[model samples]
Target: MPELPEVETVRRTLNQLIKGKKIDHVTVHLARIIQRPDDIKQFEIMLAGHTIVEVERRGKFLRIIMDGLILISHLRMEGRYGLFTSSDPVAKHTHVIFHFNDGTELRYKDVRQFGTMHLFNPGEEFQLPPLSKLGLEPLEESFTLEQFKAVLIGKKTKIKSVLLNQAYVVGIGNIYVDEALFKAGIHPEQSVNSLTDSQFERLHNAIVSTLSESVEAGGSSIKSYVNGQGEMGMFQHQLQVYGRQAQPCENCGSMIEKTIVGGRGTHYCPKCQLYK
Candidate 1:
């Protein structure tokens, strides 16, 4: 799945491609991919003639700001957005396409069919089910170190599991979680409540630093991830332990190990991130 950096990169690319374009029509090749209004036909009908003013991302969801309604999209595993001329042939697994007035189409292709779209009124989007429960954005000014540590208090879940929870913070997935934890030199299975003030500070810094650097590098391309223009990300080549199992640690030359923690494959250096 594309994490914060990957999603942010897609948003930036899509914004550049389709920000002011008007949607002439919409086609939903897969009915199950549209979750809003409970009817796929309505999803296509209402989007007709709607101008895409801007594209915003909340957590893993993409908000394509139209005239009065917001189209919320989540690109789950194996899902991507591509912009092509209308004359181009529709590729396989293309689930949704937004036909623009300029003879171009913004296509959403998902192999796993796990991607979802929800339409809501502009002001009502934040009050909706999925968006309402999300916590603060890690990049925002309100996410301070004291507040970060407060959230970890009394939580016995593994540090990685706690960080993975969307209710705690948004836009973090398996990829960033592993990368950030590894950067902070914290083991994935360490109890959240056991972290000291120094550890919390380090983890918070690592989260922001890892995400910012990845976003700057256009995100990591691991297994078919790309921006809206079909360009690949370059951050995967800079990864330390996420996909480097059995490889020497970049810092201390310790062999990186892989284990399943909270049902997710975790990679870290056992010597560097030892449990207390």
Candidate 2:
């Protein structure tokens, strides 16, 4: 799953490429990818006349804003979007295509076929499922330290699991969670309730700084992640702990370790982030 940074990158890139492009037609090569309206034809018809006003991101989902309706797209796992001339040959696994009036097409391809799309009215998207269920937008002005601490009250789950919960804070996934925890020198298995005031402050700052820096670097391309123009992210080079198992820690020179925490593979510096 692409985390906040990766999704934000895609959103920014898509806005540059497809914004103001009028959709002449829509073709759904895979029906299951359209999860809303429960009707493929309706989904296609609803999108045709609308011009793409802009592209926005909520957590890990892409919100393609049109003239009257909003299309919510989740690029689960290996899904990708690209703009190509209509004369170009459609590649394999291309699930959806939004044909523009200028002989250009925005194509969606997912090798795993796990991506999803939902169409909703303008303001109803925030009041409905998925979007409605999201918690804090960490990058926004509202994510304060005081607010972060308040959410941790009564939460006894492990630190890794708590941060991964979308209801607690949106857009963090396994890779960034591991990186953030390591940056704070807190073990992944540490209990959320056990964090001291100082540790809580460190963790909060780590989460913000880690994500902000990743977004600047275009996000970590650990898997098949790419931007709208098919560019690889550069942040993976700055990773400290994730995917560095058995490798030397950049800070302490101690070997990094990996373990299972909350059913996910977690990486950490054993010497720096002592397990309690």
lDDT by residue for model 2 over 1-276, one digit each (tens)?
Answer: 889999999999999999999999999999999999799999999999889999999999999999999999999999999999999999999999999999999999999999999999999899997699998888988999999999876678999999999998989999999999988989999998889988999999999999999999999998899999999999999999999999999999999999898899999999999987
TM for every model, in the order presented, reads 0.97, 0.98
Residue-level lDDT of model 1, residues 42-72, one tens digit each, is 8889999999899988888888898988988
Highest lDDT: which candidate? Answer: 2
The reply for model 1, stretches above 4 Å from the true place, is: none
Instruction: Give the TM-score comparing model 1 with the true structure, all chains together.
Output: 0.97
Q: For candidate 2, give the lDDT of residue 210.
A: 97
Candidate 2 residue pairs in backbone clash: none
Question: What's the lDDT for all of these models?
Answer: 0.89, 0.93
